[model samples]
Target: MIHDLLLEREQRRTISKLGLDLMITPEGNIKVVEINGVNSGSSGVRELTGRDIDLEMITDLAQNGLPLFHLGKLKDQVFPHFVSELSHQQLLAQKWMHPRAPQKTARFVLPIVPESSDILEGIIWNADSDYYVFNERKYLLINPFAVEHAAGDKSRVHALFQGDLLAPLRPKMAFVVRANKECDVSDFKPNTTYLVLKPTDEMIGRNVIVVPTEDVFCPDGSLKEHPLAAYRRREEGWYQEPNVIMEELISSKKIGSSRTGKEHNGCMRYLILVESDKGEITIKHYGGYWRLAPSSIQDSNLQRQLVANYSNGAIPEHISDDDLAEVRKCVDTFVPVLYRRMLRLPINDRPDDLPLEAYCY
Candidate 1:
């Protein structure tokens, strides 16, 4: 099941790398919260420590100038290829390699990619569709398209797991509009019940809001603009905001160094690898990380939202092996279903794998 899913191809090439964001609920259920393409770069270290800890900058120290590291099929094995950034000096040095005495001072040439075409590789820290389109033979650490499918939409991605597989891992989520044609205001609780509104395409938890459903509509039965809409920053700008996916609030136990050690809401992150070879796929468990918070998420105030994403002051912590075992079970059921739904393929389709019910409109 894993092999067929990973090895499936579009056109003539297989997806090489994928980055996923997994979350563990308060009740200890594991769920996939987001997926990222190869274009995903780690800002965890930077955000956690406030330093330029990019791999490219570190690798530049070896005089290899930012070469791409290809992870082998086996974990822990990596291969390096020289791909250097473009520079004016290098361009001039190439132009006047045999300069006469009039231009004898051309010796300041820096190390660069031997082939000009590889220059693009230096500019990219992670693989994207463009990276695969440009270099087919290069091995990637993960597949790019899988990342897009997993992280692209909140409503769609969460809907896929509404059934037995990771169903317990999911919170109460739904696609909601400003005015519900069927749902009446009586069904909403003014302050006790909270719903998290998330933009479909934004990242870094930008434009995410947690609000009381009652506030979305006015007494005149018309939709009222959410106050956060005016003050929040978004990937596509404020006025151009896309439709949102609203989920009922699920409180998580404290998973961080809160002053009171209160059971504040939090999420756990797991990193794993899916490797493919000769039409076979296998998932390797790398380990698990964490993101914790001191408060329940809120967005109505237009302040920095209380998203548990690492960027929002979430510090990393240790998770035990027992916790990882639970996470593994969720991924085992999730990956195959995710591959099937996203690709519309039956690589490892199971009749029982169908979502228990349609989760969204």
Candidate 2:
């Protein structure tokens, strides 16, 4: 569809050479998915737009610098071609609009999503929603990355589109909020007990997915991060972040490290997992080539032991006294500094594996 957007000749060449992908929404928003062989003459990168271009209106990029659109050919619905962030020099393109996530200010949920990764909460945001940019109906951008599904759920993680957020709910399970459901201030019922929520695809009240305040501090399990993202500088020295550690665990080789041989690089992804009496929990994010503490998960044998027990809803071991002390120290030291997103329980939908009696709001 980008070939039809009013684009410069250079932009078309750049998009073509890389086999890049672009997305246009029914609301006239545009997005760029991937761009390789970036334009060198454009000062490392550049953004092109005519203030706005109608995606359903045009089939080719426009060269006149004016938005080119053929609204007549588009479905009566509005269509956005793509969404890009404005930079002084240019815009970065993306595929489909960045979906919107529900974000409320309530500090209700305490425990949260606990890993570091680029998470995609399917089709949760929109251009015309009640967000910072109200009514304009645009895709969204979540600062930290994450992806979540119902707790204990074993179902397909479908990708939802922004234009279709209001469509009939198609959640794999009963967690979906029907498209016609309506919600107002009364939707948030008071919590008698501290609620714990498991991520689900369904949006609450209506077929709208909201970013719950539940502790979305980390992400839902560990997923692989791109190899090149290991280059951030921390206090100790050049180091990979906790999410990088999770990726190292998933990669073909040590993801963050560019070392030649897999000799004793000694990178391990282990943690002193903490669960609270209140059912709230905290994960001291420490996984890396440079470990801050000894490996709580010494060998694959121990890892297996923990996994087996966790499957049955049990804690693995006492956690060595030294390890305990180190974890305590780490929590005390970094809990305040660690990034966090508080989520309330039972906000989205019931978790499949979680006991209905427990973690209820």
Candidate 3:
């Protein structure tokens, strides 16, 4: 499903890498919960498994005669530093360029700047001139516009890309409330037992509110107030400032650990690399790791059981070959459909707002 999304984006822009946060339901269904374009988990996978997946990614691109440029802010501290060290050890040439720095050849650009920031100080921007910047540097600039357009708006991407092949794999969205709009409590149907309220652009489980329609009970089974009682009543402080996406809560399958005799509700992080060379696209599955919920399946806290995210103190487990094979089968079945859809659409028929220069090759 993600490969098709990448292919669709490639028709207008160049995007080489993408990550999908998947949830396996009790019925053995794979749900694509989130799509990550920038800073996908090469580093986290390494940290969890002691495998240098990022280095493997670099080697793969290098062998394919493709040089990748890492765009990020140094102050962010994690990815930029890790990529710098990895590139240095690989003997790959590296250079740092500020947004206002004179255009120069560089394999890596530190401190990723805004898309509207000046690429060259005191010079009128020219695509022709900027083309040389990439060509001369012998590297592809991971376009910020492409990243934002493709992954920033979660609700938009889901709406635009649904098909017979994708519809089953995606979680059902309840509704979308535009930025700064008030969420009408009535919009949530009474029969809907569980729902997820989150910002459309946020990642790693931040600012997520999981609401259960009925009142939740304490561990002792005593009745407690519902989590969103305030929101339901439209309390004074309750306001949805950013675009809020309401999705039906899809419960994860319980993963049993034979060695420990315990079970967990888990989420998987699958990374995929899409390389475009001479108009032919190649996709490689980089394997994945499992994030187990902090508490076991027996825990009473539904929030912890539902959201298995690394940033939220979830435990990382090495994914088994069986699990990888299952996910691979789903990808194999869906990708061809996505590709055919792209092929049917003529390039001239693509959206007019897409930047012409974004077609990297």
C-alpha local distance difference test of each model? 0.46, 0.21, 0.55
Task: Tell me each candidate's RMSD, in Å, in order.
Answer: 12.2, 23.9, 10.3
In model 1, state the lDDT of residue 149: 41
Q: What is the TM-score of each candidate against the true structure?
A: 0.57, 0.17, 0.65
Over 4 Å off in model 3, which ranges?
1-15, 42-44, 66-68, 73-139, 178-192, 214-240, 257-261, 277-279, 335-361
Give the local distance difference test score of model 2.
Answer: 0.21
lDDT of 1 by residue, 47-104 (tens): 4445332343324422524345332112222325434442434523543121222233
Ranking by lDDT: 3, 1, 2
Q: Taking the tens digit of each residue's C-alpha lDDT, what string does model 2 give over 1-361?
A: 3222212211111111011111222332222211111110111011121211223112233321333222012224344532232332221132322223444433222234344421322221121111121111121111101112211121221122112321111211112222223212122332211111222321211111112222211243221322212222213432222211010011111111122222111112122222121323344232211111112233333322112112222121222344335434544443221111111112222222433222211
Considering lDDT, which of the candidate structures 1 and 3 is the better prediction for this target?
A: 3
Q: After superposition, how far is residue 274 of candidate 1 from its true place, in Å?
A: 1.7
TM-score (C-alpha, index-matched) for candidate 2: 0.17
Roughly what TM-score does model 3 have, to 2 decimal places? Answer: 0.65
Model 2, residue 290: C-alpha shift (Å) = 22
Q: Per-residue error at 288 for model 3, in Å?
A: 0.7
Quote the positional error of residue 253 for candidate 1 in Å.
2.3
